[model samples]
Target: MKKRGGIRTAALALALSLSLSGCFFRGADELYAVPQPPKDYEALKVRLSEVIAAGGEYAAPLSGELIQTVQLQDLDGDGQKEAIAFFRFSSDEKPLKIYIFRQVGEEYEVLTVIEGAGTAINCVDYVQMDDEPYKEIVVSWQMSEQVHSLAAYSIGPGEVEELLRTDYNSYKLYDLDQDNQQELVVFRTPTDGPPQAELYDFHGVLGKTDTAPLSGGITAVADGGVQAGYLMDWVPALFAVSTYGGNGTITDIFTCRDGKLENITLDPDMGESRETVQFYTQVTGTDINNDGIMELPQPTPLVDYKITTATPNFWLIHWRQFDAQGEAHPVFTTYHNDRDGWYFILPETLGNNLTLARSDLPGGGERAVTFSYWEGDEAVEPKPFLTIYKLTGTNRVSRASLPGRFVLFPAEGLAGANDANTIYAAEFRDGWDCGLTEDEVRERFAIIKTDWLGNS
Candidate 1:
């Protein structure tokens, strides 16, 4: 939690082209081509080379096992959109890098990277800080030494900075006091150890952590931040942690000021297994409803986390998104089912009829907030579709094949946004790597000002 400085960023661009070879946006003709989503890897690489030749953008090296986190929010005040990217590299190394891109109209203009100060780190992020006018990105990173760190990145201008960094770690962000600003809540024990549930406030200043220990292990973390039209003055945050895993047993909840943990109900799967004296924990926090600006979900609320001993499945991993104001009635969840894959399950926000990509909304140059993804299977050939969806009274994802929704950047798997509609998605670079034009990557995806959620 701190204000950012441009000392590292202000000189990255000019000095980069001189020192680095073949940077994505550098003067090199051959660009570093990352794999693009929805395109065949072979073709994607080829196209990436071409796009690289076209645009000189280059991304820092990322480890294959690293989890990539990307989010789209118009960071700069100008209606154009930008991206916040976070990824890890060198499983042997502890430094985690976070990037911020500021797009001037269509091309990327400003970029900054966050170099992790601690140990080898693995991070998983969920953007929850809109409490500020700009987009706020938050995540928890486990240090190479086994310590967990929680931090937030607020995107603005062309630079990125650490809004908050906490040694005390938890699985979620919540607002204990109903002020709408989120908090950093977590529990930790030395390094590589089970954590208890604790609520924390993001004091932005480093080395400042307020802790209230719990009586027992944590279960699931949650809060009633949002209720029927009322943002609760004091959101009840819960954490489910126990000393053992399996058979599901009683969980505990901890408060910030008072170091007390209370026994709470937990999911049967959260119970202790045959392991004795060991603790299995699950944490999840919710604001469920965020009415655009006012609702900053879980100041650091905890939610059911996947920290089981069993093998983790990417397809089975899922999370939730809520409109500000609170995670009240209109909260939606990402459902990862065997048949449906991953979906935004919204019974409150989307009714029968939903509209996607309306260019005339009030913010920034009046462009639509376009959304796109692949509809085909990864194991087989790629079959991708682009569509748009508009929010409905009943809260549903009704789709429409909106025209001009895809902003095909000269690259694949790349996305850029300005404002809501003034957005661009880096398009397919089908095996055309090494040499291409910026105009070419620009041609990759169809730059459309159409709806974001499209017809299925």
Candidate 2:
């Protein structure tokens, strides 16, 4: 999902030259956001300059973590790191070339050069594919606007071997069979049929071991919704989030066992329904309880909302996880407010007799969201129990010293560029016999931060 536009060769040619010139400096008026290469990287930068000077220029990766022209890693696990650079010659017909250099006595020497076909590099990673103790390189190249090609290379002393090459829509590396070794899982969406997943393992050469049908097609794989987690009995599984171009989302679970890959959500023998989860708002799968296992979000209708209606004002998210045999086990339930970047876990005592409503503050420019008894649509009296304030600017500063209101989320790490004023506070009320108390609210309420979902 970490995609960026291709950098022009002319612009990169100058940037690469100046970035390694050893004289570029940040001015006092500048933001100083760009990072300079470390002193130890000087030798590798010099070697790169020599390669580019020969009527060639390096291109930065269009997508992936390793977007730089040069990347350093210990490919052979020999205690010393090697340098890998992506470049292309103006005179060559190929779109890209890869150069690998090994360290030798305070300098680097060329180990091998590879010819690649693609507009730009997509991703670069290393994994142990065999018992040789040396890691294999996993590189994905952008073949076109919608297609990408993946290849694995085994780098050795003066030898660079290509182990496998294939095209994929989305890819993941996981130990699907709990074998203590990694397997490559590629998801593809054919134009004529539903999407499918192909699992490959290393048997002298990387080959397809099994395949499974996905819940949805290309739209389901929107922006790379695949992830890795464990099922019941500690069995490793992959989760794919799919949307069928409607007001609903689906969670597809895939696992490998006994030499077969199965989509547990669709397998008839598992006795699980393939129904898409309908929700009024957006919902993506995540570890809501921080248990390391991803829970699928199921939208349950609110207490006062009409269950048969097509739309509901609010929803209670029931997070569920699957067992080894593809049976779902409910974990916890919460009220998720994605727009406000937070969620409140409903305690067991609260049950299903509460409802939430939002209103503007008496004064302008602030909001107060209240949770109270589930009154009917026509009821005039709502026994309010908890009121959360969304404050900004002077209101936020003044509420920090208020008496009955407790600040839940401060504006420290959740502020945006234009506005440094944001706060969520809970105002206590007296004589309301709701199952939740002030202490319980503090323990159950949480701020939603997804720093864990990096480049997935």
Q: Pick the candidate with the highest lDDT.
A: 2
| TM-score quality measure for candidate 2 | 0.82
- Per-residue error (Å), model 1, residue 449: 37
Residue-wise C-alpha lDDT for candidate 2, range 120-238, written one tens digit per residue: 77777778766555667888877777778888887655556777888777788888876666888888777787688898887767788889887642254653568888876677888
Task: Find the candidate with the highest TM-score and give its number.
Answer: 2
Model 1 misplaced regions, further than 4 Å: 1-70, 76-80, 87-95, 117-121, 124-131, 145-147, 154-160, 163-169, 191-198, 202-209, 216-235, 245-248, 255-456
Give the Å shift of residue 65 in candidate 2. 3.4
Candidate 1, residue 243: how far the Cα is off, in Å: 3.3
- Estimated TM-score per prediction? 0.37, 0.82
Which residue runs does candidate 2 get wrong by more than 4 Å?
1-41, 157-159, 216-220, 245-247, 267-276, 279-281, 301-311, 362-365, 375-381, 411-420, 430-432, 450-456
Error of 2 at 378 (Å): 4.0
